[model samples]
Target: MLPSIGMALVLLFSMSGCGEEDRRGVLFKGVVAPPGIVMVAGGREHTLALMADGTVWGRGSNFYGELGDGTTLNSLTLVQTVGLGDVATIAAGGLFSMAVKKDGTVWAWGYNGFGALGDGTTTDRWSPVQLQGLSDVTTVSISGYHTLALTHAGTIWAWGYNARGQLGDGTIEDRLTPVPVAGLTNVVAVSASTSGQYSLALKSDGSVWAWGSNSSGELGDGTWLERSTPAPVQGLTDIVSIAAARRHGMALKRDGTLWAWGANYYGQLGNGTRTSTRAPVKVQEPSGVISLMGGEDHSVALKLDGTVWTWGVNDQGQLGAGRDDIDSVIPLKVLRLTEVSAISAAWTHAMAMKQDGTVWAWGLNNRGQLGDGTTTNRNIPAEFLGL
Candidate 1:
């Protein structure tokens, strides 16, 4: 039986009553993109920008023309994603990109080394190509070497690296096309860490499932064993959302609490220490968290009160607090910044959109991913321009 979802009606242009409309299609249980931005927090070598009109802009690390800018030439400037409009969300892998259109179609570009493009070919594309054989895609998630999609019909599909069964097809052979993730049904959303070697699934009933590499207990099943198929993350239920990083995972409980597990070498787990955990542990934060993003070495959370909190590695100033000395093991407030409505993190930098439609960025700027008109790193959040 399909899980029952409570519905609330929300007006798109109005902040109040947003929950009403937000829950409209919850019953269908399709792919759920990471809140706000689509790029993996620290896995994306490029930056993805979403315009007000639903167009997308991408720049940086186009090693394979992953930017979908029609050129392999690396871009330090924003290049509008060609041939796409009415996009609802966008994501980038190591050298590939994906976007879910407003009409539920998925588009991809860049390297197809392992068939990550899901276009039924190994040919790399310098321009956007619509994914073959599926529609009603609600969310698209990309990792360093793979891709995953969730459809409105409550099914999941994956492509790319399968060396460790990361593709979850019970095989170690890589695929050059999309393949169904066996045994999963009524799935609401799917997430892949930057590595594309493990995954998490959120079902319609608010339960979480995991597969792929579990050497570090990232699967959250209480045992560090690799799973070739979906397995429930022990004791985890009623999850509203989930996200993954290189070796860490995080989820927001239905009641607005945040929990994390797996790698914490840089304190990405938000437990006030660098110790690794094998199971979900509550993140130490003072406010109720509405959403969470797990970066390669840091984590960000959007609070119910419109404030943003960050923790983990500050080596590249990814924490956006104007100093690299404070490696926040616990959620600390970002100063001089407020009214943030959405946040996205790239390989090293982070972008936050304000309630007024302005964007702000901070952290590593070596590749000009920060879009602040320069390549120099900024330790504090700075306004972004060029739309």
Candidate 2:
């Protein structure tokens, strides 16, 4: 959400956490917001923003209280998430949210029908609740009904939905608490699909591993079969990052090249084709990429040059090219956007964070996930009000 004009005008001043006298020798009291937002993430319908002050704000779908505002009311404006602070990073799932604080503790809220909350129960939480027995967490990732946490020690822990073996514990049983992913160590990153049916992990050794559903070959192990444990993604190495969609997977290699596999019925593979591959296929785009994100059937990439590109499904103008529902089988530069520092793609919408710290959004906004204080779908990128 963008900072409102009233909020911007009311910003008296911000002080550091140390409480030392500022060089300006000025002070203010009873203020909440910090300087600006540092990061933004999009869920199935909700949106989450992390401010420089370490607090989180959420908007959109709150039927299951994914907003974590201690209420089930949907919001068109941003609301401070209840009881979350000192947060280092945050992740949003299909109907849930997770945050990792500076103290290394993890917290979760929202839908828990499959025990995705990791609170030892299948009850929904309307507010942030400390995830039991998880600490030293370096990062967290969430999907439809599960969550994954990477520890400073390089081990991977998973919980929640395990159907299709997404939990990676060599079982299909749902877990209410965290469980160590069997046979995985030195892991640097992890990702889960929006369907909670597949998962991927990147190791420090530059290798990629995958498990869970392969109904569309999302596991990318040169097979169309599901695995209850982690398996090396065929022919992919020297990888730096990975992303998982509902039925497809993406990997960014150290060379800045992108690779993809699995479902491509909508040309999500970005290979100028709509064929599904059981093994990784090189994405048809120039290198120099810094990051990539996958939607349920589309993909977005942020180049090192600070430009954003997207491909695949555009039924909702998700490509941000001002085109009306025209799918692209190749990467298309997002029209009129530059200096993007980060990007996120949801089930049908997309978001971008400019280097200047302002947020922009396009595509599906039926729930005001765009945070522009409206529920209109955008075919072109527009400044989202209230950072």
Candidate 3:
């Protein structure tokens, strides 16, 4: 869920009267951050942070203008995403960035090869642009080449690549503009696989619905057939949250139990086995989970105790278990981290936000996504300065 719209507006107005010099302190908003990160989003090779002041910042790869700084140059240090303020929440896709403003309008920028920007075009944007035909939007989710918007009225709108029907419009046709998702209503939250071939929605009744590429069982319907429309996941109820990865899916029950299905070649299922399944399987250890995230081939869980655990492929130290060349079939506690408030995982890197509002990252840093001011990878968690 996203932060309240009212609070975001309050913060934005409170800092609206600052002087020019004070505004110059922060590159994008022109106002210095209030020393805390309220939210974070991870992309394939970049990351975004939303400050307590309702401003957004980006770092790492900007090859496709994913950084949203009006340039394609990547930065190791944080650069404010120009023209974004009063943002309620932010999401990062494979090579794009999205934000929901306090006014309930959605904005997007970056790679739009398949019209992921939803602005009726396929041109990449170097800075934020108001997404056409969308308003009263509560949240936005982006994947490899598509996006989803959930409006306050409980309607879900989709656009972009639909080769595998990830758009959920009951068709395999790509859309350059927002299209209503067929037959889905009362959706409280939605998620799209970072790989862009599948999607999931959690309804008000706590039932999970899936669509798109079911190959590798990503749809969790006990079938490998692809879906052009929404279908109920087998045997899942009381689910509070859902996450989709490259070829897998995960759900967090209200009781803090984590369930995984789909691809398990690398044990992303976290069920103490490397075998894949078409049905949901219980994840091992640290049951009091409050949130969960999945990467290309790994998974992460944030327990109520504020500790983080990770499993699956660690070839790039994405698991943050002090090793980078091995895989863990079961969950392992991340080294030297605690008091975590939120977590995000991309294809090969992961990030955690401590209660103090400081962000930490580890794993692949070839594009400097780690934000530690270096391209060197860390086998253990490292503090990311500049909030």
Candidate 4:
């Protein structure tokens, strides 16, 4: 049996601890995008920012040296990552980080228990090390412990943890080196869930494909069976972008419509219901959305008006709902947050870049992941001072 879920879901609890208290994140303020940052990303307990000058800055938990600064000391302020320049893209996994240089070379550091560093070994790195046989890479994505890289040639290669087949390599075995993904081409983008055992890819034709754990129907395949190979997400077309979390998948269509499927234990699916679904359901609110981001068990939307909104679990203000320890099954505006050029949502905190180039952050500050020179969690957005 599927077991009883609230409303239209099942399963008593997420095997990955998707309970009432597990969801949380930091917030940011000040319309915050500091002058040169082109992008931001977060791991389980750290953050990284890429600048227009092709350099990287980071703060928060550096345990396992995810900050790539050759140390594990957490930072309450942004610190430059050592020995990297001309970086074109950056990504963070649970406790590791990776970057793609302008020349299309990939480099990684931090937690290597599952060989997420892609150096063909299970050893931690305090500094960035280039991966072998991976070049001309255009971008990369990281989930809990696995990673996916998209090359300039429009092909996908992946490595690291694959307990749930998130690698799309037609096997469940973990990899210490990059393996070409099967049956996918002209791929424009890919996303690996924060901690879920699944991955998603968007092709140039506006179709989406998914693989790995299907528990709670996260794969959107109208079934609960897990897959080691890629499968098309049914009924989705014209998808411009996609995002994934621990147990759900979100998509934004060309028409600005937002849709989601999978676990709704905390209403992370954002369909005005607490029930999970095996098929796509329209997000009740948030129209004119230009982008979508998925936290551990929450959802974030960036609108055409440069405004931001969030919903689902607020245990640590991951929803930025203006108060802590609350959960909203429907969309709620992130109070007074606007003119945001971009946003990065993660397991315990979030960062936003404003039109002015100042970065702001909020949510769980444990380990100083908020990078506001404090370890206090914010129920609302807070400006990160002193850059």
Candidate 5:
């Protein structure tokens, strides 16, 4: 049985925010934690922290109480995502969020205007509510208006907006609950972006599948037609990790090569041109990238040497460089950032955590989403305090 949201908060403190050791920047290098902790960009206005103790902490925007802190309040301090025993993973959308527990149970919270919560109702949940009939959800991808989950058995389940067939259920009907995506199995990773109204999954065999909206060729099927079913992304064989942007998609191969497709109005595709491609094209970066993340109109990459690189729209200086007007067509190094553990990008904003346990943010700060206790937009990256 689920405990009351209040008691869950009390028990949550010890489990969720208990780990406060100074990370010498080698958490992944040592055997202390699992290898290559997954990082999702544009997932939430605030990031989700799913600790090993089965608890979740969220720090960022909470307009809809998506933080799962049992109140419709914004928190600068890390607050419990849920008062659950232990959570395995977490996925956050624009307004709603979901988590998979260690026991294969699923929980959801926040906005349900279109039934994104998957609780068999359209009512918004301020606190985490157990999802019905979903077990062993290994990973979840939350888009602007939809949600997708990959089960332990390799089956893909989808819910929320179907206006653009982003749900991939062979129909344009929005789902209030989980529905299986047809003709897909043995999937290793799943991701959804904000704009494209589509989803991508990389199978265990190094092949790529794309479905949903394709108006701007976000599906990378060489056609502008929308697909409600899974289709192969052309020229993208042997891909290992994939990322979706608001209007474009990018993938990284096992060979440390990066590829991009779809919308390129602001040079996000990094192909040294502003033209959009309907098929996968290699991103023309000279560096070997280990991690890649995309935001509303910008992208950030982590090179093999622990340095951060950024490109695309820098209207808000999301590139983390000191100058705002200087836009680079190619990847440029973000200054004052080093030994970074991970980085994430949001709308007109970028954030990173260092190996020394400090967090920094740059770009749009309209709602104080940067968490630096200031509403001023930063052209260069600034330190975020009070964590």
Candidate 6:
């Protein structure tokens, strides 16, 4: 169903006026982006890519360096995250690695424990530091150890591991730097969760908001009680796209449908049912989805015809589906992939990008994160030519 997709970080603040220049050089609001391999991120096994000439590339587990390349030593080849170049967007957490350059400023590298590398302290970087209070910052999100930033002024900034409040700011304590998530304003888009607790936002009026630890309901807002602030995710609205994982959360509606809510055990809310639900609920067969990712248990979509649909936990295959013991509550079909533009998933592994940029990966390649040098665990898709 991939109907000509592209555009995954979706935050749009207008401004493209002076011609073109944002291949990660997002400056203030132009967001231009259209060149090659715009985004891909994953952490827990490590993998990253940002190129449109902005530079930033990585491979599997660099222990704590999370492959920012300063040397925590864990490679499968593909390197180059050192001094950084334009780097418009790239994020991966739970082990750390973040970038948001192109001048908006924000950088980080590998696991800073509860500090999530906000850079104020907890110290764990091996390279790429810059995060000092954040700057123009257009986009950033990191699940499972906290991190969220979105700033062309629409507001939102948070820092590492906030227990269950996931840094929403009303307080679960634990931030090591940047803070401001209380009232939330224009908030174009944001998503955080992978075990780091919870979060979700997207408001240009499309409405969808949520805040930390709903135990298993994942803050879809039907109520499991746990929000340090934020709140509105009930039936959803125009919702262009959203995804969160630590339990579950998925949104996408401007007619293309797809909805989800809270922990489905291992079903990851594809809607075929593993029970858990707190509010929304629609995802079943694949749809025109466009793009979405949220993997701790699983959920990935990309349709309109580019073909790539996944469902919950395929154990180690992460549902590429050709094998790996089975676990789909609904959406499947990921084998040979297709046009796929971009996609990313964490923990169990999944990565994709190929509008000629190549790169494909499958679940749990142990520490090699499927760069193809192999730690072996693919239920399907494999091509990953280095970066």
Q: What order do candidates take by TM-score, descending?
A: 3, 2, 4, 1, 5, 6
Query: Can you write out model 5's per-residue Cα lDDT over 123-197, one digit (the tens) per residue?
Result: 888889998889888878786567888888888999887777888889988899989988999998888776527
State each model's CA lDDT, in order. 0.75, 0.86, 0.87, 0.82, 0.73, 0.79
The sequence of per-residue lDDT tens digits that candidate 1 reaches over residues 1-387 is 111111111123223454422432232234221223322222355677766567777656565767776755555566666788888878877667888898888999887877888888888898899987778888888887778899989998888877767778777778777788889899988988766779888999988888889877788888888877788887788998898777888888988888888888888888888888878988887457777776667888888777778888888788888797568888877766788777776655677777876678888776566777677787788876555
Ranking by lDDT: 3, 2, 4, 6, 1, 5
Error of 2 at 332 (Å): 0.7
Over all chains combined, what TM-score does candidate 3 have?
A: 0.91
Task: Give the clashing residue pairs of candidate 5, or none.
Answer: 54-86, 54-87, 195-246
Q: What does the lDDT read for residue 89 in candidate 3? A: 97
Candidate 3 per-residue C-alpha lDDT over 3-50 given as tens digits, one digit per residue, 9 for 90 to 100: 111121111211478642344344444433456788888888788989
Q: Give the winner by lDDT: 1 or 4.
A: 4
4 or 6, greater by TM-score? 4
Q: C-alpha displacement of 165 in model 6, angstroms?
A: 5.2
Q: Pull out the clashing pairs in model 1.
A: 8-20, 9-20, 9-21, 10-20, 10-21
**1 or 6, greater by TM-score:** 1
Predicted structure 5: lDDT: 0.73
- In candidate 4, stretches whose alpha carbon ends up further than 4 angstroms from where it belongs are 1-35
Give, for candidate 6, the lowest lDDT window spanning 10 residues.
1-10
Per-residue error (Å), model 4, residue 350: 1.5
Error of 3 at 191 (Å): 0.5
Pick by TM-score: 1 or 4, better one: 4
Q: Write the per-residue lDDT of candidate 2 for residues 180-295, one digit (tens) a residue.
A: 99899999999988878889999999999999999999999988889989999999889999999889999999899999999999999999999999999999985799999999
